[model samples]
Target chain A: MAGTDTSKEFMFRPTPAIVLCEPQLGENIGTTARAMANFGLWDLRLVNPRDGWPNEKAVAAAAKALPVIERVRVFDTLAEAIDDLNLVYATTARNREMFKPVIGPDEAADRMSAHIGAGQKAGILFGREKWGLNNDEVALSDAIVTLPVEPAFASLNIAQAVLVLAYEWRRAALKDAPLPFAGDEGEPAPRGQIVGLTEQLGEALDRAGFFKTDAKRPTVMNNIRAMFARAGFNAQEVRTLRGVVAALDRRHERPNPARLRKNDDEQ
Target chain B: MAGTDTSKEFMFRPTPAIVLCEPQLGENIGTTARAMANFGLWDLRLVNPRDGWPNEKAVAAAAKALPVIERVRVFDTLAEAIDDLNLVYATTARNREMFKPVIGPDEAADRMSAHIGAGQKAGILFGREKWGLNNDEVALSDAIVTLPVEPAFASLNIAQAVLVLAYEWRRAALKDAPLPFAGDEGEPAPRGQIVGLTEQLGEALDRAGFFKTDAKRPTVMNNIRAMFARAGFNAQEVRTLRGVVAALDRRHERPNPARLRKNDDEQ
Candidate 1:
């Protein structure tokens, strides 16, 4: 078992237990554990794993997800694996004849979030790596969960399937939690910085004969200002642009290459 | 080249390209191709691949994505590989020092759809296996795309990253066939135009000494490129910028504002 970090405690939340039925390879189980850990899923139940439990190959493949591998529980039958869960979703690639409610991972996650939020245990049942779970095994599940993969290549490997499901489950569970990083433009720069940039660039363009005529200066300047406004530069970016104007402006004056480089470095 | 089915033509549409930079293992490349094919993505570009092209291991591991593996394009440099792409998103696991907009997979997919729908090329860049994209590599991208994984297990291998992005892209493109709103930014400037602008400005900056040293030139140019990419300029904006560059470059061609006034007065 790998050391667990209590500080990173999202695993303690009500996440759906991952149940693999008749999983063949220890590598799949280990990778499945890795996928689960990546999305903060913890509970792992195996119904008749071919290689049995506590497999070293599974541990080696699980990487730093030892907390998930260490806590895996093996069961003799599909019924036993999901016995304690109040709700279960059976994931399958191919369309089945059974009249179960088929739902996508997002909806499944939402339902599971609601079910687990109400203090009822829930689990997702996945099938074998080769041919998936038998009809009887799937019948034990409460509903069907399928990914929206292309019809031509619908099948997803065990770990890949687990990854998508776990990702959605965590997303649903943390509905209000903000993304790890905000898409900030650094407060959109201060209005004064924008004005300063516009004035400096407007003056440079004026001297460079970009306006063509003094009468056309206002309209052209307005267009240039509008374009800069449309770009929505941050403070840092405004500073960079000012440096560009200054560098270009210096071309009309003395050609001091060394001093120009020094000025840019200081900026 | 692997035989492809014309019937599976979702790959033909304005789909985002999948680019892997310095991918170490052929197995990962093959599985990434599989993941792309599963979600109907066909374009696969490799940059400076470690094992060379047409690898047997990649073909063996690619499962049913023979078409993708067959049509793989390899480039010696990242810039060359992404030269034709109008918009590029670089995937990174860790926080970066730059100010490119950071978005999740879903948002990235939506943005890609909007860009591609407007008749512009878009691509997602995946980095190496051991460490992700370097700062300079990321700087060439229009934006930074990150996943919503547990921070403790934030990193995803090449194949997994492709799977998530490809899955979201398919869902955004197909499932939501009718976009909520039309793209307001007319068609964005093509890659050639953007590259031309960058090159022309870079030369002007070089002569003007915006870069402090030859060693610092790449970093400064990358920052400049990233800033323009982040602006998401349209064709007209690019033209306006080219004119600005030409006007700036004319500073060495004698004082012309007085001559321009005389010509305007004569008109």
Candidate 2:
């Protein structure tokens, strides 16, 4: 309402719709609502709450997020809940083996931001507690949003999963164009330049006959490259390395003590 | 006494002394204990709890972390609580502009790890619920740890503060050494090599006319160095970069471009 052309600007896009498919616990719902409030998400659609609506536990859990719970919309089915939204993302832990792009929370947030920028209403569907969304429910969404988790411990609490995704989405939406560094105001060194620096250092090492064994060559080179890459060596760093390499080469090229002594004695 | 030496090796050595200075609420204490357990902090020192020792609420709130609460040692004064510890860090929300090194939870954790590695006991001091650690109590710490939050809304619950610090300490202590690049033989890159690489990369960029402008030079160069440092480029990456720089230089140095073009046209 603040921005008349809400659909045009990325930030002013319609708030994402959150659909809970038969959420069992009121506390979980309340926490989920609180998590949503943390990131400015308001729209909440409930499809068949187990203990009925307007639960006291949920109200208590909502704490400062009471406004979010007050505006909840109830639906009889998952399809009905997502009918108004143009795009829906299903939150799940399973792989599903679906061809639809399955992305982690960060990537999903990026895609969501792009869609929201286009002025389309998007929704994220969360499953019930005890058991998550069934195959039929998952099939309704455009994409699957999975939290990057260890394979052995994939299951995440309903509210926690929602919280993580919501946080990521808000971050992606609110962030300005990323600068080269965390706090600096400059473009990153061109990718080509960085690649070139890495190559030069490698050649210098090779010229110095550092890679004595063929088997150990790749490993040694990779370690060196990783070290430099991690350091974010700019153009200046490359020059410094060349100097060191040159110094080493010059030292190696100098006549040995035995050869010098033998020549001096002959003279 | 279960495997004293073995447990000692895996035992938590808290650098930030959790000082419950005149805490009134038993439930808060329990919650704080639970939070500490969540982050692998067991050393808790109470400075005059109001509702008597061994409160049921404290135990109930501690839940699975009752062991941490049980092990909490009570003292009459804050100084006595941290006297045995080698270094002490205090957690406070209020800005105390004292010249003493103030750090965030992450840095505090790093420092704690170093102290613990050197076999020195470390502790963090936390204040009461109603009014946190007083000026005098805070001054007793070797360093102050502050959580970066909005100035207008800076307060954090006692348990939450403990949780954050605990999380950072555990992360620093438990972080696994990164796998060695192909030829590194699982050994960490020596500090000297890393420093050399950093210097070399800086020099190379300067030679390639990368940092021509002085105004934005420091920012650009520092950022580039940081990026490479974070990437941890290995030997192979360094070589790759060198080749790229060589090619660029060759292209730039090619003389008689017009003559070459004429020859091409004749051909």
Candidate 3:
């Protein structure tokens, strides 16, 4: 995907398998599938779906993500679901008080990437729709995947939970994922241009008697230079600023230029 | 509200105005509210929902989220919807030709948090569920919030988009959301303790002739010391490691002390 107004293509990569542990609603499953597809995640394993397999409702809600829905795997238990996976992360917001390593989605994604890079199968286990993965379920996994959601409302909809994890996985796994960016408006000011601009401004300030306290002159001048540096001046911007400085520094003429010239002539 | 299974309360904050531009489905709106509420976001505005307001279907899908649903506002147009907001981010995946800055949801959330902190209102505009915001609508926004969704399936459902933005906003606002944490099992080793450990290890290593090349002894020892520094060894860990080193270096109590005495007597 190309970010807005840029030619850079965001490359897709192999992502971790998504395992839903006894998900209840067909609609939630559908939305979760859609979320995964959004981030290029295809492998989906379902552990004992409440309503049963080949759910038409889920397929309908999935809309354009039939490919994921069609290839969905059904397992009777969590162990069977993740048996093939070398590393599994249990997704839960509940503080189970178990002595398990808890990690945010980004770190999990990074670890998963490393595992996958080593040709090891990796997957993330999303808990039930209602209560989430139980303590036992959480204990079985290598790490606990949690988001810093609001404590008052930590109950993220299953699909949203999937989306957040999937998004982070995309951010970490896909090195070339197009990040939102603004194209540069103009060329950066060259060293010569910046030096010229700085000197011209310094000269103008000198004429204005800006450095009245000569003791602090260097500090003030340095501050002005730092301000310009932070402004990210382009070549054109530098030229324009220099022109403004020159105009302000221009010595004033008499009321009438011709009359002033005549007066000078008489003098 | 307390996070799942945690005593810590998730404090609510004033978030950006969530403006949905001509959303088609009532269910999607309900899900959007659910997503927003998951992250403590409450402000929701709709511009010309295809089905009229007070939709039963939307409320049903909201899953008992009446607080956010009840306070939802309706507008006739996009301009009216965001007129009260100071900064606006138009959520779009399209590469529209515009000079506006394009930022990801994380940066947008950061900017929104900063704007709201300064008492300036900010809002994010979500286009229709189908075609997304038109060029004119996108042009009016101060910036574009785009996600790197899979190009094959770039159409992220409206609720998914809202949840992503809301998630990021929550992440920015709640500085205390338990991030990925490495639970330190023991306290950091004090400088004095580390120095002692380093010297002890160095002596034992020296006795064992670890530094074979005299010229590289200092460099090798320094490298070993730096490795420990990088390990971030806690006090307990350092002590345990020291015990291991002492066990490995048990060169005293000659293995044949008792055996040799018994053998000498037998002789």
Best by TM-score: 1
DockQ (0 to 1) for model 3: 0.17
lDDT of 3 by residue, A199-255 (tens): 898877877788878788789878888888876678878988988887777744215
Q: Candidate 1's error at A214, in angstroms?
A: 3.1
TM-score of the first chain alone, every candidate: 0.89, 0.61, 0.72
TM-score of 2: 0.45
Give the distance in Å from residue B228's predicted Cα in candidate 1 to where it truly belongs: 63
Per-residue CA lDDT of candidate 1, range A22-46, in tens? 8899999999999898778889999
Is model 1 an incorrect, acceptable, medium or high docking prediction? Answer: incorrect
Chain A TM-score of model 1 versus the true structure? 0.89
Residues B104-132 of candidate 2: C-alpha lDDT, one tens digit per residue: 66678888898888888888878877677
Which residue pairs does candidate 1 place in steric collision? Answer: none
Docking class of 2: incorrect
Check candidate 3 and list the clashing pairs: A151-B1, A151-B2, A151-B3, A152-B1
